[model samples]
Target chain A: MDPVLLLDVILLLLAVTTAITAMAIRDLLGSVMLMGIYGLLMAVIWADLFAMDVSFTEASVGAGAATILLLSALTRTGTRERTGGDHHLPALVVVLITGSVLIHGTSQMPAFGDPQAPAHIHVAPHYLSQDIGKVSQKSSDGATRRDFGDHVPNTVTAVLTAYRGYDTMFETVVIFSAGVCLVLLLRPRSPLRREQADE
Target chain B: MNIDGHLIAALLVLIGAILSMIRAAAGPTSYDRVLAVNVFGTKAVMLLAIIGFIGDRSGFLDIAILYGLVNFIATVALLRFVETKRLT
Candidate 1:
């Protein structure tokens, strides 16, 4: 087997192991730390797969900021394990069925770089070949030119800040709402007011 | 597929994820469970990014970024709420 293919297989196995261990650990704090390790390893995997942008985001948010926040929460609430009932057999069966379906579906997917998939054909080529402009005009040679109006080369950025701007706006609002909800839920109750009411 | 460096890295991450999941399952305290969940979210973000790379869809990076931001903000909010609950 080629070295690259061998490497890919190894990575896949590693990913599986991390997932299993994360689920099996007993100590919550230790588990959280392991999760951070998992994120970092995942970032490395992304880099290996040539998804640099994704690696950046994962490393920053998952391994860095998210872990810190979780630790803080742990500080607020003392770490103690809780006993629970046995796993439901029906749920396990359902999950197994779903997994099988997904695995089967994957068999029909296009190979990694077949070059004929719709994902490669329709979107990326247009962006790569054409220059940004206001009018979608064809050149004398019959090639198409895109209207950028002031766009960056990063297609992801264009999609987020322009094509899906409205969605992003709503997402920001959602974040704000979350903050408000936290404040409301966590606010201290008034002891003096309660005493007066009792009188 | 032949085995190599990327695959090894993936294996390590998967092991970590499994460990985190176990912690989540066995957490004696709500905070521990929350922490485990947070870890899971982080691992998920990485997994998404890795999948995008493997699939050669760099465009999915935007989704990963958005997800990361959301996960971080949610974690922070949860922590703050927990603090308040403890104080009260």
Candidate 2:
């Protein structure tokens, strides 16, 4: 295997191992720490795949935000998982079946880094093309940007902010709403105010 | 030097991350797990930087910097949670 691919496989296997270990551990705190390790590993895997923007979000949201959230949740709940009772055989069988099906599905996909892959050939060339001087402030009777100064050197930023403008906007709005919901759910009640109201 | 330096650095960081995961999985106390997690987080930052150098894209370091900041904040949050039941 190529060195880079070898690295990817190793990192991916390690991530899976940590994830399984996280699930099996009885101590919820230990499980949380193992999950943090898994998230950090996932960030590395994403970087290896050349999706640096997605990797950045994974690092920030997965390793950082998720770790803090899980830790806080542990504090609210007890530290250890309750022992015994639940059976694992059925869940394990379902996971194995799903894993095999997914593996079979991936075989139909193009090899990693295949230049002729539809994902690369379809619209990527157009996006990468430098159309610097092409212009008209309102050729289509709608306010739209012409080719500005440069083709966005980083296509990730351009695709997120330009090509998928409304998609990104809606996603951000959804995230903000979730944050507001969390504040509403988790915020401590004002004890003195509640007491005064009762009287 | 060639890209080998960056590749070597990345490989070494990967090994370090794996070792830290073992420590975390086997740790007897939450404190030990926290220490192991901190090491793993640092290794992740180094790995991202090394991969950035290998790929010849300086923008990858931008993510590494974000990871570094987040790792520190998460470690602080974890420690605080351990010290007090409430993360306030």
- Pick by TM-score: which candidate is best? 2
Of candidate 1 chain A, the 10-residue stretch with the lowest lDDT total is: A1-10
The TM-score obtained by model 2 is 0.76
What TM-score, computed on C-alpha atoms, does each candidate reach?
Answer: 0.51, 0.76
- Give the range where candidate 2 chain A is weakest over 10 consecutive residues by summed lDDT: A130-139
How is the predicted docking of candidate 2 categorized under the CAPRI scheme?
medium
lDDT of 1 by residue, A88-151 (tens): 9999999999999999999999999888987889877666544433467687899876556434
Please give the TM-score of chain B in predicted model 2: 0.92
Model 2 per-residue lDDT tens digits across residues B1-46 = 5776766777888888888888899988889999999999889888
For candidate 2, give the lDDT of residue A165. Answer: 67
Error of 2 at A112 (Å): 7.9
DockQ of 1: 0.10
